[model samples]
Target: MMDYKEQREWLQEYLPQYMTEHLKDKNYSHFWPVLNAEWFKWLCFLTFPLILFQQRKILQWTKLKSSAKCPKKESTVFNDMLQPKRRAKSKAEIYSDIYYNKRIKPLVKAEEEVGNLLEDEDEDVKAQVHKMYEQQWRTHENAAKTNVLDDDEGDCMLDAEAITQGIDDLSIICQ
Candidate 1:
């Protein structure tokens, strides 16, 4: 097996030649505008060897502790490229995470608490709780409206407000 230094030397020698040949091929003409740029080629030449060095270090570290047998394979130039695995959040999930968790959940809990408070026996207490609930709701709405004026996260705040508007309408009916 080639060590890290030998592998890096080989990549340094081979990558530019391979890139030049590949770019000259008619089949890859579509990518020529990006791939043929000198800076991009230089970046690749620098980045690939560093990636190989990291992989070799990780393999050496793992081999010290684990008895697992890794399958041997021929070293190809592109074989060590890193591909990240990510699960993209859906639109609804994005909205929920950004808006519901930060803003709506507290409002919901407060509404539930107010509903419970409305069940108290004294008329004065019920009136006070109702007024407090209305005041809190208005404050929340005002805050949300102010947030809509912000440049960052404004869209998310607007969506949150839209959702709360429906809830506010429902609360009015309930009262």
Candidate 2:
């Protein structure tokens, strides 16, 4: 087995070279600052879809000749996640929608019922959601601390909900 330093150096040298070849471009030297070993590893991982596509083309040709077929299945992680396996939504997501409807919607409706003077209601709603999310996370953290050894109930399951909500919010914001 190689030592840690040697293994790291080997990876640092090999990954970029491998990416450059797979990408079929020699003028990628300028891409070095943005592309790192981790990015190269991700690229390597994502090549499975390309391979599957190529295989599908070849299989189509053979299917025409021998009447054989390749069974189609979801291949990529993104495709699988987007396929909607009908899992239940977490409490944070449900609660975020509920709290927004309960708290923020009324404030906006009340503003609407009165007049359109407050132009910052959108900002107010965003602030309320942020504050509520922070409070939820704090509550999870406190509960986790208090029940450090209670692995049966009220352990740290709430943290997962908060994290799922954070991820959902991030995906929305990114889009």
Candidate 3:
């Protein structure tokens, strides 16, 4: 069993050399360029939806097969049971849809949905500005309440002559 420090050291020494050798191979030249392209990023983005759609189809087929096999007892495939359950869309997800459509849609007068979308963004901006203003006002009010002249009122206050005299008195006292 390799400890974490030893494993890390081994990987640090070996991984770069492995990567360099792999990159030098003829097969990697064809594959490496895909990593830098926009299509590959889009393909990566689409993978989740493709996987979800496949899962949904499998779930439906499993239900149909199970119902046909035995009417009384419930029978389910282990593979189908192991499939990840799709979660309900959260507030963030709902917001993302609105945001995506707002950005993607054309700005045309006839399209009411586009007009409504713009209003949502404008309202959000206005609310954010109002919140920022309130926060600034609160900070300013708190700063005003704090005394800024405390050091000047105390014995710590001293002119250049006073400081020099105090240093001379300190030397005389020490002697």
Candidate 4:
């Protein structure tokens, strides 16, 4: 069967003259050219609803005897997900990745970096700072063994006021 474009092409030769003659009485001048080709085009378009109905009837007409092929959709290329999935991932993997990543490595790296920072200090301050890190490393080691090293820890180095208050509080508690 011929498609709408083929049917429209055949009618287009004769329909323009018929439409222009019939619609010329209206006040609109701009619509004449559009209506010429559009009338048959629309007539063909109107047939599509019927054509679709016929297609459905044909499906039912030969339900048991005939096979028809339907159009296939192209499969999409999706990226492999990153480590932290947007949805529906294992929970233990999240905590395990962070236990090593966000917690342990940065703590150790910051402690090492602070030693690098102390290299620019006066010899007296550098010696004292190095000694402080030795004590901190021992505390960190013990904390690691106990398995109670805080997951909530940030940047490893204790704040100055907290360190001072800790020493003062220790002295008070000792007395």
lDDT by residue (tens digit), candidate 3, 1-175: 3333543453345334434554344233443353325324433435354656643553354346433432442335985679776788999778778875675354443476755664667777878877999999999999988868555556565699999999999999999
The candidate that wins on TM-score is 4
Clashing pairs in 2: none
Instruction: Provide the TM-score for each candidate, comma-separated.
Output: 0.20, 0.18, 0.19, 0.23
lDDT of 2 by residue, 17-131 (tens): 5354534543444544444455445344354545566435533533353222222232668877778768788998787777997788888899787665434478887688779
Better of 1 and 4 by TM-score: 4
Instruction: Give the clash count for each candidate.
Output: 0, 0, 0, 0
Return the lDDT, model 4, position 144: 78
Model 1 TM-score, 2 decimals: 0.20
| Local distance difference test, candidate 4 | 0.59
TM-score of 4: 0.23
Q: Which one is best on lDDT?
A: 1
lDDT of each: 0.59, 0.58, 0.55, 0.59
Q: Which runs in model 3 stand beyond 4 Å of their true positions?
A: 1-121, 151-175
